[model samples]
Target: MPPVPAAVDPDTLTSLLDGRWAGLRADIRAEMAAAPYRDPIDLSVEEHRSRVFDQLTALAANDRAGLGFDKAYGGGSDIGGSVVSFEMLGFGDLSLMVKAGVQWGLFGGAVQLLGTAPHHERYLRRIRDLDLLGCFAMTEHGHGSDVQHLRTTATYDPDSGEFVVHTPDRGATKEYIGNAARDGRVAVVFAQLTTQGETRGVHAFVVPIRDDAGAPAPGVTIEDCGPKAGLNGVDNGRLSFDQVRIPREALLNRFGDVAPDGTYSSPIEGDARRFFTMLGTLIRGRVSVGGSAGSATKRALALAVRYAELRRQFATPDGEEVVILDYLGHQRKLLPALATSYALHFAQEELVAALHDITDDAPEQEQRELESRAAGLKVANTWHATAAIQAAREACGGAGYLAENLLPGLKADTDVFTTFEGDNTVLLQLVAKGLLTEYKDAFQNLSPLATVRFAAERVLGAVAERTSARKVVDRLTDGDDREALFDRDWQLKLFEDREQHVLGGVADRLRKAAQDPFGVFNAAQDHVLRAGRVHVDRLVLEAFVRAIARCTDPDAKALLERVCDLYALANIEADRAWFLEHGRLSTGRSKAVIAAVNTLCGELRPHARTLVDAFAIPEQYLAAPMLS
Candidate 1:
């Protein structure tokens, strides 16, 4: 284990974790501390919704809502700052965090990014100011993950110069639309557009769902989805249209448009390509979801760690009670997860900066890479939150299960994250598809057979070539397995080698699908998913490595190095069976990895409070009564 200072300053660590948006993070933290906010544990569903809506309105009043919008529309025009602000909200009520994301990051973002100049001029300011609370109505009963084939239609009637949006069947109804049950006055509805009798795939349109009197528009039907497992404060509902008439200008025509004469035109040649390009421009929502999930995980750990420190159990021979955190079992549960949280925090910071810096005119490959990273990280962060928060709750035992302690709410609220923005399973496949195709027409085809065939034809050679290169590099290792376990270069190579081998193996299995693509791909589905998981694992480790290099303070740097080691070694230990199976590690070396993880846990147990305190969560969010 590397030497860490006896006591490192948490504030110094905070500065490094804050990254490019430190000022904004500090301001938001201060604002949250001063705000009149309370956890909604005891509030009724309607009452909680009311409280969250008020908070959203107050955020808009302070101009915080305009941070990501264009300055031309009275916004601050700071993209990354806006995301950081949303992440900070996760320390408090998650319902508010989700509500704010729907308002600014999704609904407003669609208007700004997918809509044309006229749409922006008409809606962006209103959306920013909360004068027009809206729903992002994309998900439907039949098409959640497979959005390219949505059944809802927006048919152009040139005779009336209007588009009639309709739900042809029950499957076309928009399900779980945020704000639709009560608050939303309009919706950015996604539906298949038809012009001159030619149906042209999925496109977004600005459609009014409610009138000034708070009644449904003439042809719009809205039904509350009722209380959910969590996030009751969000008024999710089902929306269906019965020949709702919207003007020709309602189309958000950034990539595709229809003329008054019923002529359809698009800069992109194919429907799939254009729809995906539109989706790529709106990746901020996914990025924000992942960041918010990380924040929630940090809050859970802080609560659990604080309780562990104060709650004493069992007596030692010296006649003093041992702090629960001293137990190897408790440390094993929380410290590795804490270290992983640190790693994810750095990776998220990198992803946000990339999203903020990429130009609109950048190559398609860059955009695809950015989208892939966003998808990959969202899968990582949300799944981590689900697992880590549950562990935190269990770590605190009975006290953690109480609603007032906040872990219960955090667990329930974040549960939907794995499926809402994109199903984690589907998103992982998307990541794998991008890898298999090298970003060439990857997003254009998501069907199983197409992806399998594509990988067989295009990716097999690349995988083989990378495998050969890895072999040459492997022969150069120093052969001292025990000492090399802590070497950063060795860890990097092991992760890289594992990814190449898994990916190549998948390609080989897929190459035999010449007879029955779907059946072959289905049998090898687990392998396909593994390729995606390992690829993301490598990216996250690299991001953590890069972040450590950027640290300037010696004490903080030294502490972070130890934390990163725990992260790397713990992950390897968890997947040791794979290494053993592949002959990458001997039984003795594999046992050593476990011993190293245990040693790191004991070494880090004393500094648990300092490590979590570096997150600098608002004291209000961590105020569980048991901790007192």
Candidate 2:
């Protein structure tokens, strides 16, 4: 690794970090600066919701909110730019960020992706212009993670050529639905469709929840969720349908449709396959959530890093106070997390680009792979935000706890991210399921011992095939323990090997599921999660490596190389016990990994400000009285 320069140009780092969406980011930053955006510090829940709604309308009026929609609907048709715009909004009020996501990304996105041509023609422009605010009513009170078996029913009433949308019981009521409490006039509701006496699985329908006067429509019960821990600006509400009837044409029938005669037809055969396919089309929402979480983490780190550089503590023998960041403990708290934020940023950029470029006709395996990647990155980014933001709060001491300091809002608003888009634990298990089955029948066969055995048999061979060019086996045999700790290839090999080994171990344990499936799966759950986490860690490291290769400036490139090293080594150090037990790293090498992390933290400490500044968050958002 090259020695750190006296200083690296932050503009260069910013340019490299911006990647393909530099213009959109700059435009959004300028617009946010111009808007009356502020954290809802002391505002009432109603007041906060009003303010966030106004902000959402402002975003819609500028067309910034519709970048992901089709151009025919007065949109920019820039999917990646749309996601980047949402991420940039994370630097400001999180409530507004989420409001925009619900309006444009979720509500509008469902109408665009799941609905057919006539549905789009009628609703797309209105949705884009905020003439029609809507909710994504998918999560029922009974089923948050398991959407496949929702109790809500939309039975076809062929006599009147209408479908009766009904919540069978309290469990079927949609809970925590954004836009349902106050602003939403309509909702894209998910319910099991039944026609001709046969249930055709879950499908989305366009259900109007409110009348033109903004009152709840007949048979639609809307209940405000009330205030709680955070995000008071969002008007989350519960929705229940008491035999609400809508025209047959209200169904978003691109994947599955029913005729006036009550006959159901779909291009896809099985209900499970068709349902998964529909959900797959909405991957942009998951990607946006992860990217927004990254931006929030960056903001927290920036605030904490700047505070560390300014706040002076105990004096030395020379009677001069030292900056908190000058201490190794402070660096340990912030620097490695800072490095991880950078890595996740690059991985997120790659994901947004993939979402932008993927075609509707892309192969099923390719689509599934993209979904798995989105799920994994979401897990990584959100969990990192939760931990790193808490760390930032602690690093700022009592000041961070105050709502005035901004860290409190950041911490509270982002706390639900880990569970909302998808629960982090459940999502990790999904990733492991995908890997074990190679995306084959992943949703259908959740307990496939055959697939687990197949994956275990070929997992090591696949790892070797990927790292063969780096000659990881030969280098690990010949390289010195101290020197090889800094080798990027060695680090990559370690991550890959760990994932392969953990996955194999999980398979071995699950093989006994032939007798007691529940007991075996319960016992091996930890190994399953580790397999998912290590796989994502390896991908994030690779993304950082690829991003470093794209830097044109020598100093910035060198600086990024060291940042990448810190990220990789810090991960290895965190999981050193696994490596030590598996005989992948010697006792001396494990200790060397820790030493390398300490050394890297010291070396990178000088550039911490530069690292956080590259995120280029607006000054207005980072304005805390403590910093002054």
**Per the 3 Å backbone cut-off, how many clashing residue pairs does candidate 1 have?**
0
Q: State the TM-score for model 2.
A: 0.95
User: Ten consecutive residues with minimal summed lDDT in candidate 1?
Assistant: 469-478
Question: Each model's C-alpha lDDT?
Answer: 0.89, 0.89
TM-score of 1: 0.95
Question: TM-score per candidate, in order?
Answer: 0.95, 0.95
Q: Output the worst ten-in-a-row residue range by lDDT, candidate 2.
A: 438-447
- For candidate 1, write residues 499-561 as lDDT tens digits: 877887776676556668799989999998889898999999999999999999988888888
lDDT of 2: 0.89
